[model samples]
Target: MKAKNGLNYESNPKHTPGGQGFRPNAGIEPVNSFELFGESVSVNLKDKIHKSRYTMDNKGNIHRFSPDNRGNYHWSGSTADKIKLNIPN
Candidate 1:
């Protein structure tokens, strides 16, 4: 489905049994959302924001996380810093 940040954040058409592909059975994904603030901003302020987070954790399932709750999440130790990863692509 079309997401807030203009991405086709859809599930994998070929759902493999052991693949890390998406499961679009739900709605769109979060990383496909938009970023509202910069590193100079604060995390406390950003955490209160809604409509920006796409993933959900119910029961025991956990989706990926974007530090500061922005649209950029690094897979644990994927980087040394989260804010710096937002270097204009």
Candidate 2:
């Protein structure tokens, strides 16, 4: 059984144009909330540039998610504890 307040469970499928052997779903949510935040920044370090981002979930936690044309969702992280946004692709 999957947790209700933590890393939930999901099942996605990978397929080609035609019907063929399918693969396990790679897009699985590791968290809960679908609401996510995104911010980008550039930092200077020893004459070098570094890019970083700040992503947050609706409930407050690092988030990572991808949306399909259909706007479907997936995940692969925890929501309550070990919070990490792992949205499906």
Candidate 3:
């Protein structure tokens, strides 16, 4: 059957038109909130690595924070506003 997007769902509903399978939250970890820079920020455990951290603001914008050589965290950059964690504090 053809889906509304014109993709053949009969073959595999899990895949899209280009054959890329849909994996919801594929590599995403649970979201946790933390107080960073005096503001409540939501962070994905998956984005927390040894060198950097990723946080989401209230407007669903992603911001990257990394530590300097002196071990002070600073805003690195902003990422695409795709993932939103609306979990309450």
Candidate 4:
């Protein structure tokens, strides 16, 4: 599937001892901008402030984040704040 931001996704599957299978996947590329205040705001992954806790750009703009209580990170700075990731079928 394609994300709203237009990024394409790929699927990865894992097979179990039985015929059952599962898939745990991730985005192939990092997402850049987010819809904030009705506009797109960029997040600089290179300038991370606290080891993935926040993303800051050259202009010093920051995108605050938090753990999902899982192993993944979640963005919380905008209305559609979640990372625009493509989910592969």
List per-candidate RMSD values in Å. Answer: 12.4, 11.6, 16.6, 13.5
Per residue, candidate 1 scores C-alpha lDDT tens digits across 1-89 of 33344432333322223446534332233232222111112223345643222232333222332343433432211112232222111
Q: How do these models rank on TM-score, best leading?
A: 3, 4, 2, 1
**Tens digit per residue, CA lDDT, model 3, 1-89:** 32232322122212222335634532222132223323423355555534555556676665554445654454433444234333321
Quote each prediction's TM-score: 0.22, 0.24, 0.36, 0.29
Clashes per candidate, residues 3 or more apart or on different chains: 0, 11, 0, 0
lDDT score for residue 61 of model 2: 58
lDDT: worst 10-residue window of model 4? 10-19
Return the top candidate by TM-score.
3
Cα displacement (Å) at residue 60, model 3: 0.8
- Residue-by-residue lDDT tens digits, candidate 4, 38-62: 1322344546433233345445555
At residue 11, give the lDDT of candidate 3.
23
lDDT of all the models against the reference? 0.29, 0.34, 0.38, 0.33
lDDT of 2 by residue, 1-89 (tens): 13232322233333221224344432233323333312312245567653222245555655433234453433333334343334322
Task: Score candidate 2 by lDDT.
Answer: 0.34
Best by lDDT: 3
List runs of model 4 lying over 4 Å from the truth.
Answer: 1-52, 78-89
Evaluate model 2: give its TM-score: 0.24
Error of 1 at 59 (Å): 1.5
Least accurate 10 contiguous residues by lDDT in model 2: 33-42
lDDT at 10 for candidate 2?
30
